[model samples]
Target: MSDLDSSTPLRSAVLHRDTHFIPKKAIGGKGSYIFLEDGTKFLDSTGGAAVSCLGHGHEGVQQAIKDQLDQISYCHSAFFGTNVTEELAQLLVDSTGGKLSKLFVVSSGSEAVEAALKLARQYFLELPAPQPDRTRFIARLPSYHGTTLGALGVGGHVMRRQPFEPLLAKNTSHVSPCYAYRGKKDGESDAEYVARLAAELDAEFQRVGPETVCAFIAEPVVGAALGCVPAVPGYFPAMKAVCKKYGALFILDEIMSGMGRCGTLHAWEQEDVVPDIQTIGKGLGGGYAPVSGILINDFIVETLDKGTGMFRHGQTYQGHPISCAAALAVQKVIKEESLLENVRNMGAYLEQQLRQHLGDHPYVGDIRGKGLFWGIEFVKDKTTKEPFDTKTRLSSLIQEKALQPEYAISLYGNPGTMDGVRGDHVILAPPYIVSKEEIDIIVDVTVKVLDEVFKGL
Candidate 1:
């Protein structure tokens, strides 16, 4: 490497997704908006990948973190326990209605996922009759778990996995995602489609040898990979049934769709089935702190307790006191303010606005999702439901336009919805604190962005 000279102008010291594509720095933010260093404000409709549930500048959360910092901020999980961490765990365990009775806190969603995977394997090994062969995992296609090695291996986003194919573990397999927009056959009823998907999952279990499979992982609502696609009625319970029959654990990755991001506190609450293991992040600390965790079902906790008497996995920063304190305050705000109810009421209003404005747009192929989480998938031909070519980068273009001076809005773009490389969509997940006026602004700006981008196409 050549030595750098002080005379030479330097590029961004921080590495972003594309080194050449340096984004403007956001200097300040308040509820539902972010202010760039240039003083341009953007309506934060996407909430930074749906993490800022409480939005920015909440005095209550800020105070909690400050209090935690004053008392104690760090502690090794293996050595000692903190009151904030204990309280947070109790709150989570109770939130699951005793179904998921244990909590394993981590620093991020990927770490939480890795913890869940390891816990599942350990659970099998600690069983009355050990199952060393139970090492395989089955997740859905076009699904995203996390960026870590094991999490990436279990994920099914083809484009993301291709470069790291040789490095990823080979024990994970994929099944079709429950994407009704394209996956449902013409003239198929909702019930028929759900049955077909459940059967396909059953077939995959058989093909992979049921006894060797440890768990089936999926997002209750497909997040970034499929642009917030929720399953049709009875789809989740049906899939859970197959896991039950095959003795495989049902692992729900709710990093994006859980913790009241959807209408319910847990996405599976609406699906009518509880998961054996669940990983959640993003909204957990409302972006105030880096925190994520795995919630273990009662039976799994019992199995490990009765056998190993210890969890074999841990992290130095697990259950960081400051993170737990921040999350505790965030959860308190949600419950005390009854934000879940707001999520439902506002979610309906947002959906109505999206339909009213974009429902008739020729390029808008599908609009689906629940609660505050919604997706608008674009297409080349509405009648054929054909996606734009990957090279067109339609979703990215719309995103770029939406952030321009005229629009001053932010949204989340996701490509590769049809397969792992051939579709485009954008997710709109405003903060739960969003008001009617904000929703109107989001819809109006979105319409302008879409029209400008596809004006000639």
Candidate 2:
């Protein structure tokens, strides 16, 4: 629409996620907006899948990366450790108040989840009285952990897992997610719903043999798969209780919901539970670098400390110095700028604005989320809560329309919100530095886009 004509054919050597539709190239950005190569400026509402907490170009993070490059760029985790890496790890551990005692850095959320799964299994083997039979993992249905084989194995997003079923691990089983919007029955209270979901988890543990389980993995605030669904009150504590009863580790995948995205340093903090293993990414490095990591509780670390004295896992870029430096600087900026406070204030305003603007739309089924992360689910009939047919691809259409020159906004949209196949929802996770005015723009644009899309249908 700007520099490149839409009718022009485009070709590239890089294998894209969607081969049929090549995305617009982003040339540069700064502070809550991205500039496309075609000279279009877009409001980054979803923060590039909720990764850019500090937004596009922050001088502090850039300087940190440059300073690290000036010193050392790469060092094998086994052979040598850098001061920046240690500082980043200590900063993360200290943020958790030492409850989660160790951090294992990696390159992405999927890698962090992959590490979590393996570490859960190894933790059992490292026990004084080993429980090698504890080889199974239990995750919740309609949840997403990551995309790699092992991470994909434990995730329950039906559509994502369908094609890779044969290759996925057979040991992982799925239980009911604490998704109250669809899962809660009529007349059921929050406590009742949580109890029911917890019981379902316990039953799954019994069915799979509790003694054979390695961990019960779930997202404190379910991401992508459920569109920013936060667990009902007492949900995590109840689930953690079941895990404790079965002597299985409790793992929280906070890849998209942690690092102050949900108005807390850790989502589990609000849930009144602390996971034995927690995988975090997205906001960890604020998209300044490709970085993610898992935090381990003292018990898990102590077990390995006394037994194997090693994690027995290695990656070529486990603790890249530049990545660590970038993340450290991002964290400091978030703290010094008091951005978490902005996340809370702006988040509340966002929720109010979303509900006020779209809550009563006939096709809009549910408006939900916490802090800066929110989602709007669409349905054919709000009264019956019936989803539109998958053939319509409503979410994709909304996302595509929002990216047009008129709207010029970016949103995270996905289908299968109900069962990973039938429902549609779009998420809005603006940068932590976003303001009420920016939130207004995001909501105003979202309203126009939704109105235009649904009106056509």
Candidate 3:
């Protein structure tokens, strides 16, 4: 070990997550592309797992963060609420047509979910018709809420929840997800499918005794777990009706789909029903600052305002002023630029590019999604719609190949598509700022990588 004979180890000191192969360092980003340390540029198609809605290195967002730092950065919510946080809350509540009259900011999607669950429980305590027996929750199978204890307990992703089964809430149960692609029976019409799913939820509420079920939570457009799948028409209204009939809260987790990632300002806008409580993240701060929050409708907010007058749940970083500033600026830019229109127009273009490039691939089982989000599912038998085995690692392999410097296109969540274990699918939630040429490159790399991976398999 003398200086003259010194040698270097192959790796660095940072603890690397082993989810994929070693990730290269990204030097900087601008618009729809990011540059690596080796001077390799990638399309950044998935916007860093759908977190970067405004793309990278946005000047205005950076300015907002700096402005907050100039005045104050850290102030506990217990003492005072910052102006930045106050305005952001107003903006979010106003965006929901005043239906969501209240907002509670937190640090991440998981925290938001935890807060929402607690809020629902507290709402019951403040209810005009109090029902202390209401403790049960009904979430959908193959859905993900968050990684924290309560959120994880309510989440039904089989792969994620399997290890924690012993610790999850026994009061929580799972019904079927609105995955029409796989769940809908062959002969069932859309109306029948929606009705059948509603019936299942009704049966679940009855089994637990409707009075015992506190909430029915879901994602308006299912993300990661099911690969950008949207519910069929009339699904949300039907689900909302069931919740209302049983006096259960409807909590929509739009952590991945909200904040104009889709054509509308919210994914639920297209669903024809508003939720009692909604969780949103990822796109909230556009990856400029770590932030998320819960939106409570008039009914829930009014209940607490008159009774408890304070939320029982609290977090150390709740309503951090700096995070709120960044989010406030991000929302301003969206309105100023009219980005939702861009999402719709460009989304149509993206679908066209995907169909022209990958639509005919033999192993490609399905290509579906809306607005700026999409998913490509792989299968062993396209006709039978059977997924490739989880151990095969087909999706991850394709994702890895796409992320190579030569490929230069970063894909979004490479989720296990089958009950969270034995399926293959990759998400494409490119920034709304993506251009025509960038869209073509993303599709090209994906198609090329799939072909290469399938041949090897």
Candidate 4:
């Protein structure tokens, strides 16, 4: 009667909804491939939610982590700071164009976003009365930063925010995200689209009372939400100008799209702008360990350094020695081995292969991305641009069916990607270490699987 019999898979694993169960255990991994318990290999196309930049396991990463364990295992930041922590902080600051004014290491992207929001609020409170009048934040809808309550409050994701609506922050406002495929008008030029979005942002700042806005947040490459949706040309520079005019901070969430996934160390580098507060994760430690952080600009960092003399915001694992060490190793390998070049080369090959294979498919509505980060949006009618019904779960079908022994590739994302629901898409952000041959295989298997699934429909 309990439905909890020993025969049930849930009895041992405690299954959750939206879970993917690959029969074989992923016992080990190396350079863009994961090995199952039985030794069957699965190419990690999505990098386990777009995290692993350097791929499965690297000698430099493992050795750095092991070296850290030899010296120190755990130490509170308040009590003491290790040499490696200071070194890693310096490295991040120097690498990030010398504008990473202050560094605060956290365990995840959500944590970094939460910290940034709180810091922004604190920046206002630190000001004298009648100060900047910045108490509100403006973000774009169809975006995600983190799942914690505060970060969730500012996020524009429909599905994740639905359950906790009443508990989220009210001061956060949302504008339309820069999704060229869905948001762009059919006849409007890209310039016109950028101008329209910039005007909308200006209007929101005014409606919120220009002086009362804290920051405008967005993902530079638009990962996870709209599926690798980059802003139209001149979008970010215009948006940044608006924020500067209002004296509000610009926050860019690069958790899923940064760390060299987009052919640059920082996606903003290609956007021709910099954020006042930026968040990075996923590829930071290359999944060898959990690590994420907020890279603040000089103005904000100096404000905190001078205003309160302390950030007041921190985490127990803010600068965990081992996590930082792993990330340091990850960054070193990325630089020394020059993996960003691979991202560019492999990305082009991937694009070409996908176009050759799926470019003309009836249901493949759109294929767009940068570097190794790409997404495939499915439509019921390509001519009309109509999306599949949300109930059909078309994205999940292809992902699940792709798990057949002969064709195993990881798919990342969910429904509601179109207007928060009523559409489907899947993202593939293979490791920067991916190869041309592997890219071809991924495209072939993906095409075969899509054909297999849609044939019955």
Positional deviation of residue 95's Cα in model 2 after best superposition, in angstroms: 0.6
lDDT of 2 by residue, 100-158 (tens): 99999999999999999999999999989999999999998888889999999899999
Cα displacement (angstroms), candidate 4, residue 248, comes to 0.8
Highest TM-score scorer = 2
> Which regions in candidate 4 have their CA more than 4 angstroms from the true location?
1-9, 13-24, 128-133
In candidate 3, stretches whose alpha carbon ends up further than 4 angstroms from where it belongs are: 1-13, 19-22, 413-415
The local distance difference test score of each candidate is: 0.91, 0.91, 0.86, 0.85
Candidate structures ordered by TM-score, highest first? 2, 1, 3, 4
Summarize candidate 3's per-residue lDDT along 1-457 as a digit string, tens digits: 0111114333545555652234578889999888887788878888877889999989988988998999999989999888999999999999999988888999899999999998988899987778789888999988889898899899888788889888877989999999887899999999999999999999999988999988999988788888888899999999999999988999999999899988888889886588999999998999998999999999888898898688888989999999999999999998999998888988999999988888878887788888998988888888898888777878778877787777888665455686777787889999988787778778878888777778898
Q: Clash totals for all models, in order? A: 0, 1, 0, 2
lDDT for residue 97 in candidate 3, whole number 0-100: 92
Supply candidate 2's per-residue lDDT for 89.
92
Q: Between candidates 2 and 4, which one is better according to lDDT? A: 2
Q: Candidate 4, overall lDDT?
A: 0.85
Off by over 4 Å in 1: 1-10
- What TM-score goes with each of the models? 0.97, 0.98, 0.96, 0.95
Candidate 4 is scored at a TM of 0.95
- Which residue pairs overlap in candidate 2's backbone? 416-421
